[model samples]
Target: MKRGYTAKELSGKTGMPSTVRGVKARAARENWPGQRRSHSKAIEYSLDALPTETQIAIITAQSQSRSDFSDNKQCFPAKGKSPPFAATTLNDDQRLTMGARLSFVLEIERMTAEMTQKKAIATIVALSKEHRLDLFLHDRLVVANDRSTPTSTLSERTLKRWISTYREHGEVGLAPGRRRKNLTMPLWSTDFLRCYQRPTKPSVEASYMEFCEKYTSDQPSIHQVRRFLDKLSPEARNIGRHTAQQLKALQPFRRRTTKDLMPCDVFTADGHKFDAEIINPRTGKPYRPEATTVIDVATRKVVGISIGESESSIAVIDALRNAVQHGMFALLYVDNGSGFVNDTVREIVERLGGTLTHALPYNSQARGLIERAHKTIWVNAAKKLTSYIGADMDRQAGAKAFRISRKQIRENGGTTLIPSFETFMAGIEYEIETYNNAPHRGLTKVRDPITGKRRHLSPNEAWARAISTGWQAIIAPSDVLNDVMRPQVIRPTRRGEISWAGNKYFLDNLRDFHGADVRISYDLRDASKVWVRNLSGELIGEAHLDGNASPYMPKSMVEQAYRKREHGQIRRTLEKLRMLSDKNNHMSIVEHSSAPILDAARLAEAKRVAKALIDSEPTPFTLPPDPIAKYQLWQKLNADICNSLPLTKDEALWHSSYQTNMEFAAMRRMFEHIES
Candidate 1:
């Protein structure tokens, strides 16, 4: 016998094609033994391994066969042409059940191949009875008699039914159909649920009752309605019941980043009410003071702050000035507070080459950095105080125990518990200093090149670093700062003195500018001095309040004085009305009686009443002498001498008459004083 033969040799010996390609093709078509690679990397058949007779039979079979090399049993039929029935509809569990059913059916079919059908059935039943075929069962089959006990056995009828289902619809037909319930609800319940889920957020019970009244039938119980409502999502239930601001808090928002911003590039400002109470300097009452703060967005440093009774434009301006001392910022971001949105603030920002931007209404998140600072710095400091009224304080117990009213404290002489306004401000300043010196997590750590030591960056460190890098702060002059921050009013100066807020402001600088409109800027907190600015925005000089004017006068004293003068006029008018009434009564009696009853007693009584009224009237105070008035009189005289134009005969006569009338009026005033 020969060793393994190549395809060419085998083809030649079997009387097939002679060429290698033709022989290889014939060998492949015949499903012959596979070829193996030899040591020389040439293809060789292993037909020589088989017996000579067997090889001859294989060659004869290959030549006679007309099929392809691949086995027909290994190939699957194309889908949809002849697929396993309903296989696509079965899930994994159902498929496993169906597979087990098919396995058992196949076992029965195999057993029946060599036996009678009735005998096969009986054999399967016998095997099931002996528990030999239990492994092929879908699951543990329940026993019919004991219902609680489970066994791995199926009835003969069930086996027959499995076989029948397989024959009709393949494996999928063995899967149990899904069971469904015939659920029904009242019509009113459906309507109520519909209304309940709407964005209007109608009350569950109310909606249910309304549905019942409208439909007049099939109303479900209120408890049932509540149960349905409980099934709804909380977010859905709160839809229209919550405000837009509350909804915004629940919605997703993008966090802002200041990574690209440099120190002094932007600053955010906001006002916070200090959580603890301090004694008001002016009122001596314990009250929460408003703290206006400006924080650099990049460094998270409190650059400027002002403590005031309320948040006002002046407080905001003071904060800006403080922040500007460190460095002039490029932009200012603030909320839509009246203080932040005014013209003075806007002008100051523009003058410093910066822009002021207001955050969206009710959107504190836009200024979240500064808002967080308020809690981190001010609120934390407040927590240490006994007068803290923060939300974290216990309302029922802690508040009642710790919170003391201003009146109660004053009456009880309890000054030990509350700090004065100055002390509170000093505490705030210390907190700010500590905050600026503390390491900020938002700042990047840097290693000192000279010391080779790592240092955590703080607000103060960042500010210093920025300044060393050539950043310059645009600081306003002290005079300009005082002028711009204070409120300004255009008032004409008379006699080198301008009356403002019930006080006269006089300056030698205004001597030459009498009757000229000048801008007077005065601080709200201090009325001792006012700045006099020319029309061109130049600071001419400072004017001092009159020595007689009270230093502690209120800012609204101008309006108060006007009100007092009007009240005095009203009293005088009332007195004159009484006198006129008495005179009118006497004249009416005189006209009706033919004889004028000018009784001496009546005249004396009337005269006494008139003298008492005159004496009761308040005496007017003397105004201080004005040098500007004398200067104006001298200027008028000088102008008259320089005039060369001759007056007409009628003008000269009128001038003489005007002079004679002035002389006569002066003589009459002298005579009247002498008589009195």
Candidate 2:
């Protein structure tokens, strides 16, 4: 209906640029349909004659340039204000795409403010057709890279839909809806997932088949089922299928922070069976020795280590003794093995003014630092040895490779490729020294504030730094160390002596403790001495082995000796009984069949025979009265005899023979001597 409008009339109606020359330039740039004459002629432009895109562009530019329509305060209608669409409606990348689309639409709205509703819609459509609005979605939307194919531009309908959404719920409403595939899981899907998540851990095809058997309808493809399972987090997928320990191994763990700890604050101890075989000192056989190591948590430094035939409470105590040499620690962290939970270890910790803590059962991960050290120091060193038995080694192959016969070794000059136990221990020691001196990633690099020198420290350096900063080691005295390190047993003292391990240890201080129970701490290797402490842990005194008791003898030997003595006594008693029985039998037989006169004569004959038998033997000479006085008189007589003369060799021999004969004759002539 409106064929033409003058520039001033159009400017007054739509609030566009007021000057005709400026309007002419804008229309020309947008390629709007218009007629221009000479300077004297009036230029006329028709609204219906212009192209749709150019008309919309001109209207949009005019609307945006006006001051009255610049603000966005009055865009929404007033009922209850509609809430903005949530970002949760889309995934991360989709949300970003939606945000970019909303920004584009808002810019179009700002530019097209003066256009009528229908014209603005037409302008948006025209912009979409020319691909002018598509640049705003650059990098935000995914597209095919083929340049031969036409660019995939947004549809006018889609653009209008976005505009309507932005108008309804502000910028957030432009976000796309939930993806079609993720809307709802199929009816059989839940059961299938349950099967997959069971402890038996059925495969995807297995679970799908089971689900089909149970439901008999609405079965999902195996690929679909696999996709569903793949979407779950590793932990969820493994929940019921894996053991708690296995799951924990897969999951991440928080590292312990040692910022507040000083050297000797905590010590972690663990026993590791060495990977290489060596001669067992006790058995003299090839064996894998268990080594117990104690490490300071703050420095990651190995404070002590003890290698033995096997891990035991005694071995743990020995390691603790070695660790105490470096410094006393406040806490001991160990696993719940029998060696760590014993009363001896607990008592030792208490005596050292510290606490012993056992890690959670079956959770070796808690002691990961020490475990890593085991791998670094011990396992690495073991790989160099010929008898390595690591996990990667095939069991049968490793056994064959390491097996060397005793005869073979002897033929080879009594030498074996395997290191001796002592050499193995020395190697371990060297590894520990290297580990302590090597730079550790756990320690922080720091600069000395006073010296302005930067230090990247090893474990030992860290420990030294801590010590220099006023950390004092709570070391036990030698006596106290000796007392705490040995194993303790409570035994009662008898007659001022305490018997331990078949050896009786006696001390004058034990006199007061006789018949009293005292705690005895003695080293198994040296039982010659034992430390006696009261029940209250007060040291009474050290006791040494009794003189009569052999320190080398063990309890079993002592018991054997006692049994032998009892057996000898029984044998002697039986011999005497047999001899007495024979004599009684002979007497009874002789007296059984005699008349009274004959019996009297026979008894008198028996008496005479007994007297004759008795007279045939030598009698014991009685000591003379006043033996000391007699001895003095004899000494004087002997002096007088010596002063009289010295005897010749033959004469001396004859004199000695005469003395022996007189003695023998006196014993033989007992009846004659008595009568005389």
Candidate 3:
């Protein structure tokens, strides 16, 4: 055989690293057994001249022969180092004969080069047409009819087996094995067999096993049966993780379809558990509150929700409001929780634009969309929580222990608890936003028939559409109470002061009726603000709860007393000043100065009256020559310009043009001067 060419020769031909294995595969597949050259002018290399693994394999096979003997005596010593015969006894003729034989073999090899080259050329054409000659190492043959389904998960060993199977039998050999028969076991009807069989589903051997003793009077040995089962096909005897996977793969495909529900035509709202803490209403403490949430059926987006300590109708109402704020819905699908069935809640739903419906009484899957979103929000919030070390030291420390473990998920990426509610809410918002925009896997990239987008319209967007369709109805704040809220009557306390449950409230306008009767109506859900009305149903005022009576009073009482105190203080101060002035100045001040000292009290009153008069009809009013004079004395004074107060040039002009009170005109000119 010819010695193979070096790595450089292969590089010159194929520009690929020369490997003995590659050479062998080429020699075997291309039928290039020895040094050979065929279309010499072509780009192809002479395989016979190239080094190959087959040559190396042949050499390795003849290793024992090389180790056993050598014609040259000096080359290797005998087992016994000193030979008994003289070294010269070895003849040149015998060596020459051996050399001639080797030469003859080499000459024969050289002569067959053309024939081998021709044969190799023939083989190459045939192989190229019939077989791809595709060879792979430790790798897999992943086959899938659909590209969307992953084909990369195939294992190396499995692939090698598949390749071998394919080589022997072609495409038919690559078929997945049939379902295992032994794994099916056997089923026999017996007296107890009926007990294990479900009302629905198959009656399997395992299900009937319990009755074996009673019906057969003896149970078959499971081990023996298993051995018998092992005699079946390889698939039948297979055990462990792979068998389970195969069983699942064998199952017929099932499809889940969503109904083409209208926007707000149906809604799903429910509360789900979250490993989170919010203020507990019953205890007035923090605990993991149920996250009440609702979703729009058409958009498949969260519409309304509330995070609170309880899942009462109040919470449901809050979530409903959230959904309602965007638009009205026709039907509300909810879990069969006590809160949903409550009369108060039903009334609220009916009063609004929606009617309540229960999700499959006991099965939660009916409302899977919203329930799933609740879980998503919970998980997303928890994930965000892990990184949030809150400002509250105590909560921060507590949250470290509350961290979510990703291992618990059937899938990956669970959220951990964070200390800050604000941060948690922000994360929730981001998640919802992303979820709404993301293209659903089932929808592919096809445009929605309704909105012409891969994603369904978001709640707000869908609501906008509904509004265009004349489905939007405004539920005023007052109507909201009767529509979706529980009402509570807040009657005035015995003191004619209303008590908003535990908090006190008063009507500033009803000061005289402080000890009389009044009634107020407010949503029982939130006791913070109430509507004050008389015995009749007319709304008179709005008042907030009084929590503290500091500053020696409630807001209403304090404001009242402050006004009275202010007025009295001003009256007394002005009276004192006016009395001093009355005694010191002209005795003609007798009328009102004697009436009161007339400090800032009387001056402010007079100013206010004058301002009102000027604002209303100012034309008819006539001022005295000197407005400061006593009224009786002024009545007798002349209406002549001589008796009137003196005016500046501008004032004189204004007085002449407009009907004027000389004193008042002087006041206007004075004001104008001050402004300038």
Cα lDDT computed for each candidate against the true fold: 0.67, 0.69, 0.50
lDDT tens digits, residues 405-484, model 1? 54468577545356666456556766787899987877888886778988778888887877898866666677556655
Pairs with backbone N, CA or C atoms under 3 Å apart (clashes), candidate 2:
none
10 residues in a row with least lDDT, candidate 1:
66-75
Which residue ranges in model 3 land beyond 4 Å of their true spot?
A: 1-216, 223-259, 281-284, 386-528, 531-541, 545-676
Error of 1 at 502 (Å): 15
Q: Write the per-residue lDDT of candidate 2 for residues 1-676, one digit (tens) a residue.
A: 3355546434422334657776766667866565653453666678765556645655564454333323663344222225344555557755666766766565556656676544665775576556564565444323311124555445556666666555545555666554355635667666776777788887777877777788766666778777776776788778888988778887889778887998889999999989888766455567888888999999999998877667788889988988998888889999998789888889888989889999987788899899999999889988867678889767886777665635555565323456555456556666787899987877888775668887657898898888798878877898778866876779998877987755778888877877899998876446578888988889888888773355678989999999999878655544444445558877343466442223466446555655575577765433233323433443444565589865445444444443332222333244355659
* Candidate 3: tens digits of C-alpha lDDT, residues 425-497: 4345555666666544322244578776566444455545657877655544746544334333546454335
Q: Given candidate 2, what's the lDDT at residue 80?
A: 29
Query: Using Cα atoms with residue i matched to residue i, what is each candidate's TM-score against the true structure?
Result: 0.47, 0.57, 0.39
What candidate 1 gets wrong by more than 4 Å, as runs, is 1-217, 220-234, 396-414, 441-457, 461-483, 486-676
